[model samples]
Target: MVIQSGESSFGRDSVTRATSPFLPPPVTHRKDCMSAAVKRYRYLRRLFKFEQMDFEFALWQMMYLFVAPQKVYRNFHYRKETKSQFARDDPAFLVLLSFWLFVSSVGFTFVLGLGVYEFCKFLLYVIFVDCIGVGLCVATVLWYVSNKYFLKPNYRGQDVEWGYAFDVHLNAFFPPLIILHVLQLFFYHGLPILHRTQVLLYPLVPLFLTFIVSLASGWNIIRTIMDFYHYRV
Candidate 1:
């Protein structure tokens, strides 16, 4: 009796619970774990089906993440209420992230004047090592820590899913990835040192190097003046 009670958990209604014997249950009758497994399986399967993914909703979520993150949370809440899970069901956001990573790598290739061999190597490292590998490690560590240390004693049959943790990391990574990796290249063009290097590498540009260098380097003098008169605040 005690063993049976220990195995049981309060149902969603909070009045009673569905339980089983100490032995394994038959496959014909699905259990709580199987339902979660099915959800995970379906989510992974959708990762390969680009046409079936909802990319428009994913882009909307990305935009709102910067403007109004609360609106995105409301959608997450709705999904949990309807689907019984907080992890995403579609893989569109991940696809978009990968797309941006590829585009950035390509831009760097020409900007750096990388050879064909170097370009291929750089592409592989950024996509696989820098992004996917780091993401997996971070997701697994946080998932274990959250489940092990944060769980309430009374909250039986409840835990954080690993997929949800990965989803969270992806959401947080998107903005910084765009700002730092994609946007910083533009600023480099306006910097004196980088502009000189660019002019040397591409002689097709009609601008004189001395004129470009003086114009670009004036920012240093402006910065020095600003530093001398530090703001009172």
Candidate 2:
């Protein structure tokens, strides 16, 4: 009886150990999966924070560029022309204008080169900056044309009524300019200077800026034209 009891007890102990191995492995696997998930989440959170910081920095940089001495010089020169026709017809003014046009064109070409390089190198931040630069170039061109032809003619009129024509022109120019400038802040300054990552995000910056400018321009044109029509009647 003692021998039989001993053998049965040993068999029961062996069965219990066999089942315990299977149970522990499943529990271990679950723990490992959870740990991996937690690690991935943390990594993603850090990446997002980094990107946000980059964007903010880029924005500050763009503002600084826009308000720099060169920008002031340009603005003053343009405004002076509007007030005094002397500056308008001056050969020097044309030379300066030509210089600016050439500079801007060169800058735009450089931006394109940089953007392509960044895209190839997988540097997202640089790409974004390039995009912003392109947008600024476009905005500058639009501003020049609007100021030279549209705003100047109206302001030059001896009895220029502050009527629909004036309103429409201002409306058309200001809204698009503002929108493009805002986009420039995001694409050129925010993404590249701040984040310093040359990633896919850079390309989107230009596209967004362009979209905003186009939308604003279209809306302003329609609104201004409608206002002029109403005033005429």
Candidate 3:
């Protein structure tokens, strides 16, 4: 009787194993989607290696750096512990981010300005002259800061990476650029439409927010600079 009972249990186990799927259909689909996303992210990261250390993480770090630069600053300095050095101190990342921001500002400028065409001549000029010029200026400024400030004598012997300086400068500059673009958006249309509606005061909301963001960005930059100074000396 005991032998028969054991055989019955074994038969049931085999049947269950044969009928049950390894994973539910929803779970399998989700896993496959996640894997594909990871693969795509890796491919993009490799393609843009110089400018984007990690495609997704860089965006998040930029967001964090704007809001909490000190944390990102420290993480960059102490990379061994934090393992976030790539996102913060990648030279290509800085160049690309700076260029991206510059392009965004330029695009917004074009949108806010007269929607007129100059036989593609003015567009070419803005793309080649204004965008490239602004990008180069940002790079030069970051390079200057790297050499002038962070590379100075360090009493604590904590070495400063040039890339980190660039990262800090990029983060410091991003807020003002972003806020200025937003302000331009409101200044361009919101006020004009509100004025037409006779709602003169409503337009101040976006302007006020932009002003506050600009101030916050400046403060964040000051905090980052102070942190760098402390790290230096």
Name the top TM-score candidate: 1
Off by over 4 Å in 1: 1-34, 193-233
User: Any runs in candidate 2 off by more than 4 Å, and if so which?
Assistant: 1-87, 114-189, 192-233
TM-score for candidate 3: 0.41
Q: How well does each candidate superpose onto the true structure, as a TM-score? A: 0.65, 0.19, 0.41
In model 3, the worst 10-residue window by lDDT is: 1-10
How much lDDT does each candidate structure score?
0.70, 0.38, 0.50
Q: Candidate 3: misplaced stretches above 4 Å?
A: 1-47, 50-52, 80-110, 113-159, 193-233
Q: Tally clashing residue pairs in candidate 3.
A: 1
Residue 175 displacement (Å), model 2: 15
Q: Would you list the rank order by TM-score, best first?
A: 1, 3, 2
What is the alpha-carbon RMSD of candidate 1 to the true structure? Answer: 15.1
Candidate 2: deviation at residue 140, Å?
Answer: 21
Ten-residue segment with the worst summed lDDT in candidate 2? 85-94
